[model samples]
Target chain A: MAEPTPELIQRAQRGDPESLGALIVGQQQYIYSIAMSVLRQPEDAADLTQEACMKLLRVIGQYNGESRFTTWLYRLVVNLGRDELRRRGRRVPEMPPMSDDDGEVIDPLQSLADDDRWADPAAVATNTELQGEIRQALDSLEDHYRLALTLYYFEDLRYNDIAEILDVPLNTVKSYIRRGKERLATILASSESEKIQPPRTVAKSDVPVSQPRLARFAWALGRR
Target chain B: MEHCKEYRTNLALRPDGDTAELSQHAATCPECAKAAKRAAAFDTVVQSAVMPMVPDDLTARLLALVPGLAQPMVRSKRWLRQRRAFFAISALLSVIGVAVLIYGLYILGSYVGVSEIWHTQ
Candidate 1:
């Protein structure tokens, strides 16, 4: 999502209804994507997205512009996601907070890092089978790994931005991505093996890939 | 062989880094070259998987909320407008009523002869 202009953000902070509507409309999809990555269910994600928007409307005046708006918005969504997970009786794993010393020590090798590879959107759009397998694999990951991977690859956030959002050290973000990818690779490899087996009835453990729902409401609104 | 291990570790840890030296090593090493290719392919798949297709109704659902969320603010504006209208109407009616009462009193006094009543008083 394009970052809402600073003027728009300022207007929103001052409780301008048009600006607030624009801001929320622009961010709704992004919020939903983050929610889906965390909750792994469409209904839950949708509910979370609505909750976040409502919460944003109520608390937008409190925004101080001390950080990037997206960063602040991300923190909001992440916190809400955490709370929702907790409400569902899921354990939101706590990573150690970044100490001042840890925060100050930036790795020289990390400075040289260029881990910005992302899937080509056109390519991803066509690879339905691989996408399904990957989604299943992602769904099975722990919350931390899933969240880091989603923010890094999908949101295209830098490691430092992710660290700020996740409230962890920079190295911790890297560790999550690396370990997350490793686990994903392992899962995909195993799934590939299972796919090669003789045809059998669908098992209870199998999950079907969810179909993307087209926004009929959006289309209707546009026509109006 | 040692370089191969280092290259693979770097590939796994930081797949898309400024790896000019690593690329040079991989070019000379067949095993590392194959490893790099596989790693690239895997990264692509993982990225595709992690990025979800957001539901279509999400934006509409959210925008639908904007009006409700903004209702309290809107309600206050409407109330203020109504209050201002009420006050203006009240003030205008009061002025007209007072003017009519004064006119009627003046007409009564003129008919009754105010000079005669003042003399009697």
Candidate 2:
């Protein structure tokens, strides 16, 4: 995540119009990516992304500067997503308040941090039209779970960071990733094909190797 | 495959990489190990596939919708155009309000026989 400079943040806080615009442009992609990944239809995702931008402008003054500005910005987008879900009459997860639960909460991040998190930073397998298949499976999961995966996998946020943005417990974020993956596995299993090779491109720079959704694509094929 | 369930469950939990327990379990249990490795590989595919591909003009396009970010904070042309009706309504209301206030004051003065244009000073 690109941390906006303190000078930039202060300029935004001071309501410098240019600074505000800079802030929006800087975070637009991350917000758009999350919105696109979670929602099934591209149009809906586009609509929600626009809504989030307007929302940020409408409420920018309310930003207290207590939490990281990015977190606050994400929360705004998440809330907009929740609102969209509500409008569609789809069931959505309850949003928790963003209290100062920092160290006060029993974050199990440390225990898992050393082992689980470090297990396989880069995914190293793939084959065929795994992209569309994964998208289909992803859309099938519940909105909250999909949002969790979007944050954890795509946005590359930590469990606690996701929990903070979604305003849920860390365990809940962990549970969401686990369940979402399992559900995705089940859906992709419904279809099959062969041929394999990992994609040469992973826009993300942090991890050299990307995930194995194609492995699951083949893994799902093997089960059939 | 006894440890497979726990291993898979753990696989789902971690943000990146495999956990030590999962790695250890996979080491001894070939069935689960292979499955875990494959599953992890599939995870990589999922990440790459599911990534959102946005347009180069996405920021400009989306920022256009944001109320303040798209235009200047003060008296932007778009802002003026969007709020013209509002400003007009406000202006009308102010004109009416001043007229009513003057009329009311005139009536009050006339009733008390104080002063009026018709009655002179």
Fnat by candidate, in order: 0.40, 0.42
State the number of backbone clashes in model 1.
Answer: 0
Clashing pairs in 1: none
Candidate 1 has a TM-score of: 0.63
TM-score of every model versus the real structure: 0.63, 0.57
Pick the DockQ winner. Answer: 1
Write one digit per residue (lDDT tens) for candidate 2, span A48-78.
7778877777777787778777778877788
- Cα displacement (angstroms), candidate 2, residue A8, comes to 2.4
First chain of model 1: TM-score?
0.73
Candidate 1, CAPRI quality class derived from DockQ: incorrect
Docking class of 2: incorrect
Candidate 2 regions exceeding 4 Å error are A89-128, A193-224, B1-9, B15-36, B65-121
lDDT of 2 by residue, B80-108 (tens): 88799788999999999999999998888
DockQ, per model, reads 0.17, 0.16
